[model samples]
Target: MAIVRFVLCLMVEILVLPVTILQYVGIWDSLYKRVFPHLMCRMTTTINDKMGKVKKELFDKLPEFASSSGLTILEVGCGSGANFQFYPWDCKVICTDPNPNFQRLLESSGAKNEHVKLEKFLVASGEDLSPVASASVDAVVCTLVLCTAENVDAVLKEILRVLKPGGAFFFIEHVAADKMTWLHFIQHVIQPAWRYFGDGCYLTRDTRASLEKANFSQLNVKNIVAPLTSLIKYQIVGYAVK
Candidate 1:
């Protein structure tokens, strides 16, 4: 029995679980449309762990980025509005995604901000966000959201275009598999299937270089090498001042 349970956990950890692991960890808008299997709602019913809360712990490390209030903010690739609760209350947040069902679910979740319902839940792509004005947004937060966005460069350009001159861009992304032998091997082997079923999420991408090349300067980056969570180990969590 113990061995069976261990095997079950291993299976879940191998990137195929009842729940789309990308949705739970990546929290990107496109996961529902691109990555998730039908009947994936069954997994959400069992999720007790809060990825957003765990992610919020790294926020205090970003005192400068947190000081803004009432600034217009955009959470590009906002998936299911899970990261919505972690952002500051005063800043107006606009969450965009391509999935209408997830958008309606987010709407029905009654996800509200202090000032208003997080404004403008739109059916949009990150590469081309037309509704938002350039140089008008004060901050952009991308949390584990880069891997699946159709064109990362276009999205980065959009981020640069929208951000105000001293605005902050905070992100927590799951990058490519690290140099570790076992994980890298698995990641390489699963890359094809992951692309097909995991919503175009690559197990490999230098997430930091994307931010750096966009003319944004990195503020902090932590490489978490914790066990059992090695798949997300190559993490880059920090804010860049534009």
Candidate 2:
């Protein structure tokens, strides 16, 4: 057991430490921004295949919650526009992400998903959505984003600020596994390296707790296990009204 543990630690150092070092020196950000969109695009098929039903159920409720003739949605952290196809036809989408490199990929996705109109892609973080007007959008969508947000509370506030009265905020995010479980232990063990490789994504964020405290007018969230890696399988899928 001692020898096995030593070997595993050595492997982690050899494989993961260099990337962590690059991140520390700020070289990783430039390289990751260019590479991540393509990687996400490649992985979209598998991800959707596993989580499509939940996403459909979440997005299908847009008309029910929205009180607009032409739905205008603001999608935060709209990486590679993975959710573009899921949106209702003719809905106008405003996309935002911290990484500017995703703009090209988002446009490409918009071309493919021409059913939904792509209004524009803004390079902005979720915590500061000053580019969007207050109470403007019919709905706000955030998928797989809260775990990586620098300030989840600030992002929630911004989401609330931009959404129209009675407009809904839809989210599908990975969250921390139950405490004291083997998966939770593994998540902690690999979190340092995961954050470096995944561009600030936290392996053990209590995002549900943050949402519950955000004081949304109506909040309905539930836990589900996604067909993803064990480290990020435990997830929450639901919407909150503001």
TM-score winner: 2
Off by over 4 Å in 2: 1-17
| Clash count per candidate | 0, 0
lDDT of 2 by residue, 12-109 (tens): 66688778788779899889888888887788778898889999998999877656477999999999999988999889999999999889988998
Error of 1 at 70 (Å): 1.6
Q: Give the candidate number with the greatest lDDT.
A: 2
Q: Candidate 1, residues 1-242: lDDT per residue as tens digits?
A: 44754564466456554345554575543555643533333433222143444467754333344334556778787666655555554556777776656666566443453433477787788899888889878778787678878788898888888888877777778877655666766666566556655556787777777776776754556665422255655667667777
The parts of candidate 1 lying over 4 Å away from their true place are 1-54, 60-69, 110-116, 226-229
What lDDT would candidate 2 get against the real structure? 0.89
Each prediction's TM-score against the native? 0.73, 0.92
Of candidate 2, the 10-residue stretch with the lowest lDDT total is 1-10
* Model 1 TM-score, all chains together: 0.73
Give every collision pair in model 2: none
